[model samples]
Every structure is written in C-alpha cells, then in structure tokens.
Target: MATGRAKGRGRGRARGRDETQDERADRMWSELIQEVRVAQTGVQILFGFLLTVVFTARYPQLSQTDRTIYIVTVVLGASATGALIGPVSFHRLVSGRRIKPQAVTWASRLTLAGLLLLLATMTSALLLILRVATHGDYTPWVVVGVVAWYLLCWFVLPLWVRLRHTTID
Candidate 1:
C-alpha cells in the first residue's frame, strides 16, 4: 500500500500533502477568500474615512505639502481597495471555466498586490496624520519605525517560519 503523501499527484512537491491539483486549488481558493475578506473590510473602512477627510473644515487649512500627502494617501487607499476586491470579480467572471487552478494563481497574485498596496496606503495615511499632528522632525522617524514593525509582522515572521519549519520535500 502507498503512503498518504504518495496517494496524490502532489507527492514530492512543496508540503508533500496528499491532494490533487484541483483539490489543492480549491483549498487554496477558500483560504485566499478568507484572507481577502479581512483585508477588504479594513481597506474599505479606511478608504471611506479618507473620503470624508476632504470635506472636513480643517482640510482647507492644511499646508500644500500636507494636502499633497493627503491626496496621495487617498489614491493609495483607493488602489488598495480595487486590488483587494479584484479577486471576487475575477472569480465571478471565470467561474465554470474548469480553470480553477489557474484562477487561484491569479487571485493569489492579486491578493499579494492588494496587500502591498494596503501597506503603502496605511503608511502613507500614518505619515500624513503624523505630519499634521506633530509637525515635527520625529514624525518621519516614527513612521519609519512603524513601517518596519508592519513588515516584521506581515512578512518577515511568516517567511522565517516557512523557511525554518518546512522540510525540503
């Protein structure tokens, strides 16, 4: 009798789990959707709040530089929202095409792009807020530290675990 890892076409691959291409794709798609949902909610709320900032009475009093930062931050937030939501539209349009594996790959790429955009949006927003509130030289330094923290939390630790815990299947 064959072992569990040898029972599927994915044997000898990455994690060496027993799953066919379709099964793997299905599982990945489900996981991706859950991740996207969380990101989408955050981006949507941030973008909505960003949209309201311009209407506030204090907006017109902001310096030219502050206004520019605000504009850039809003644009980044909008772009993040679009990319994060792209997978849903992509899946809906391509469903029943029997190309789920390919669809999942594209969706994952979109999700990654969305995450990077979200990171940019968040950092930009933070910078703008800090500059407005502090108007001090330390604001940029503080923003840099926060960005590093985000990178560590979002990418570095996960990558470290993936590198350290997994075997070379």
Candidate 2:
C-alpha cells in the first residue's frame, strides 16, 4: 500500500492542501488571457483609427510640428498594438511545450510594454488634437497636465494602494 506522501505525489510543504503548481499556473494563464483580450481590443481599435487619420483632408493641413507628433503617435499606437497582441502569438508557438511559467512571464512583460506605449500614443494624440483645436499658447501646458493626471490615475494610485495593503510573506 502506498502512502499519500509517496515521493513527488502528495502536496508537500503546502499551507492547507496547497494547489498543484500546474493548477496555479493554469489559473494565472487564464487570468492573463482575459486581461490581454480586453487590452487587445482597445489597442486594435485605436490603431485602426490612427491608420485612417493620414488619409483625412485635415492631415495635410497640420503644421510641421503637429505632423511630427501625429507620426509619433501612429507609430506608438502600432507598437502598442503589436505588444498587446504578442501574448497570443507566444502562446500559439509554445502550446504544449511545458513552458507555461516562462510564457506567462514574457507575456506579462509584453503587456506592460504595451501599456506604456499606449500611454505615449494617447499623450501625443491629445497634444496634437489640443494644439489644432485650441491654437492657444496654453496647449502644451494643458497636454502636460492631462498626461500627469493619467500617470497618477493609472500607475501611481494603484502602486500606492498595493504597497499600502499588501504584505510580503
């Protein structure tokens, strides 16, 4: 008769019947996929919209500086869309390779990069739009203020709350 503790069989050093590593990995993967799905849709739409802007009549009317900004924004958006969609490609290539942990790590990094790129794209887009719409001296200041607000809301607050509430064990 084999005991539950047969070497490498039963849960070991686990708090309250710890889940198998595979199970934990599977759960994390599913959560990551869900998050990626949401981000992918948003970036795809934004990138599509950006692609069409160049064909618009107003595009040629933009000042040289605004045109440069528009170009930067479009490139940033394209990069972001690629990064956000990278996980799917990664998963497809590595499926059944017993490398879920590594795949998850890489995917998470890509997602973060995508987010940062998206931030840059949005900021540049806003700056260009505001410059065209307002034509005032304060456009740059307004763009900076809005960018700062986005940084605070998207990154700072979440990090602060996480630091305040989470405990390292």
Question: Against the true structure, what is every candidate's RMSD?
Answer: 3.3, 5.5
Cα TM-score of candidate 1: 0.91
Segments of candidate 2 deviating more than 4 angstroms: 1-17
Tens digits of per-residue lDDT, candidate 2, 1-169, equal 7544453445543223245777777777899989889888988898898889899999999999989998999999999999999988999999899998888889889998998998898899888889889999998899899989989987999999999976554
**Pairs of colliding residues, candidate 2:** none
**Which residue pairs in model 1 clash with each other?**
none
Candidate 1 residue-wise lDDT at 39? 99
Residues 82-128 of candidate 1: C-alpha lDDT, one tens digit per residue: 99999999999999999999999999999999999999999999999
Question: For model 2, what is the alpha-carbon lDDT of residue 44?
Answer: 88
Candidate whose TM-score is highest: 1
Structural similarity to truth (TM-score) of each candidate: 0.91, 0.86
